[model samples]
Target: MVVQTRADVGDKSQERIADVLRQRFADVGLDLGDDRIRALAAEVAGA
Candidate 1:
């Protein structure tokens, strides 16, 4: 697993974070839904 901070990705929006997470998951052949991705992104963003 890899980890990155908001500064690393250069964006703090939930949509952007979700996109990053979505791509990372896809890199490993795993697909997540929007709701799940958003939830995870929210957690990552501390929302």
Candidate 2:
């Protein structure tokens, strides 16, 4: 899923959000890798 946030969100915050999302997805049996989630997070963060 694409997570859109305010452009002001920092890179580190985006990464932390992505990490949480990764774990949540994993808990549901979806194994979206770090690279993919990180990319999505960055993309939405407008990085």
TM-scores, all models, native as reference:
0.74, 0.56
TM-score of 1: 0.74
Local distance difference test, candidate 1 = 0.74
lDDT of 2 at 14: 76
lDDT of 2 by residue, 1-47 (tens): 44433333435577776776676678779988888878867776667
User: Least lDDT summed over 10 consecutive residues: which range in candidate 2?
Assistant: 1-10
RMSD versus native structure for model 2 = 3.7
Taking the tens digit of each residue's C-alpha lDDT, what string does model 1 give over 16-35? 88888888888889888889
Each prediction's Cα RMSD? 2.5, 3.7
Q: lDDT for model 2, please.
A: 0.65
